[model samples]
Target: MQEDVLIEKIKKGHKQALRLVIEKYKHTVYQVVFGVLRDEKEAEDVAQETFIKMVDALPSYQQKGFKTWLSRIAFRTALDAKRKKQRQREALTEYAPSKEASKSAEDEWLQEEKSRAVTASIAKMPETYKGVVYAYYIEGKSYAAIASEHRLEEKTIEMRLYRARKWMKQHWKEDDF
Candidate 1:
């Protein structure tokens, strides 16, 4: 069917028209999202979301080039998914410790001791640095969250973390643990 005819049918709530639209443009939408996300699963998910958004926004859509508008939506949806995934990765890295596949009792004890020592070191830092360090490293809060919680700018939170690390390097000793 012609694009304009299909669109008109869709506007009138024709189910077959919606299905035909999906069949006609699904590959193009998937390719557009996949090009940006570079992950098959994520691309598929974002492409589905793109279609949903298109359906919701269709009533307001001008009769411009449909493919161009659809591709733009797909691109933005993929970028948003990519950014969300990145933030999740950063949070996981901040909170989770790297562990070997297997560990003996001695290794477990040593790990616990190291964790305790690190906690102690953080506790001993200056009051100004302590909150940012704990929120970021220990609590796994993002800079934006920490800044909002403390009513400070994100750059100030970053600067505080940098200074905190510098202070730790100056004051802490490996032998002390």
Candidate 2:
């Protein structure tokens, strides 16, 4: 059948025209989707989806080039599927720790408890030393940065950290962790 005749039949809601369109374009659509997705099952699925979309969108389609328009639908559908899969993979990786991390539920709990104890110990320190210890250790700031922020000499920041460590050692027990 001619392309223009097929399109007119399709526009008039002829089932035979729809079936003929599918038969003519299925392989091209599958290949286009497969080129982007690289997975046979997903490519097939996207190709099917493209045809369904074509049926819905046929009324609005300008008769430019039927093959070109159909191929564009297939390409866009495949790209959308690829992007959705990538986003799902990223979401899984963001929260899932690597096997090399070797952290158990018990280990996580113990680590949280130790952190709380350390925080309590730091809170008990004198006001001047507390800021220095927090900046250098918890906040991971350099001595120079801490000094600049606090309007003090770098040497003063170092001395305060030293004093804080000594205070922690004397006041906090090993069991506290």
Candidate 3:
């Protein structure tokens, strides 16, 4: 069957058209996903999802280069899956303690209390002031990057950082920090 005919059948909700679609493009889609995810099993899964999404979106298919469209779906699906996997892995690492687990609860409580006090101090700052401060210091964003991301002038970011530091010095304690 011609690719266009198969796509038309898919748009008409012919279930068997999905098989032909998958058979024709599975390897191409799988290669795109695997290039990003570097995992064969995950690539296979994303390839399947790409075909499913393509089938569901068939009505919108413009008969443009179908391979290009399918490859884009595969790439995006792989990227999304990679992000989810990364988040899960990061969560595990964030909760795992290399040494902190050996410390007493009182030690951890003291740390938490200090963090809370500093947070309260930060909360007292003006909203516009806090955003730049967090972006530059807490998030470690460069002035140029922060300016671009927030659509602010670089000098404005610098000024906010200066004020936020001064406010921190006046209101926050070293012990609490």
Model 2, C-alpha of 24: deviation from truth (Å) = 0.7
TM-score of candidate 2 on Cα atoms, chains taken together: 0.55
By lDDT, the better pick of 1 and 2 is 1
lDDT of 3 by residue, 1-177 (tens): 888998888777788987887888888998999999998888888888888787777778799999999899889888999999999999999888878667899989987887677567667788987778767766788999999999989998888888878877887677656
RMSD in Å for model 2? 10.5
By lDDT, is 2 or 3 better? 2
TM-score of each: 0.55, 0.55, 0.55
Candidate 3 ranges beyond 4 A from true positions: 103-177
- Candidate 1: pairs in clash: none
Candidate 1: stretches off by over 4 Å? 97-177
Candidate 2 at 125: error in angstroms?
51
How many Å off is the CA of 92 in candidate 3? 1.4
Global lDDT of each candidate: 0.92, 0.91, 0.84
Lowest lDDT 10-mer window, candidate 3?
A: 114-123
Candidate 3: pairs in clash:
none
Give a tens-digit lDDT track for model 2, residues 97-151. Answer: 8875888889889888988888888888899898989888889999999999999
Worst 10 residues of 2 by lDDT: 97-106
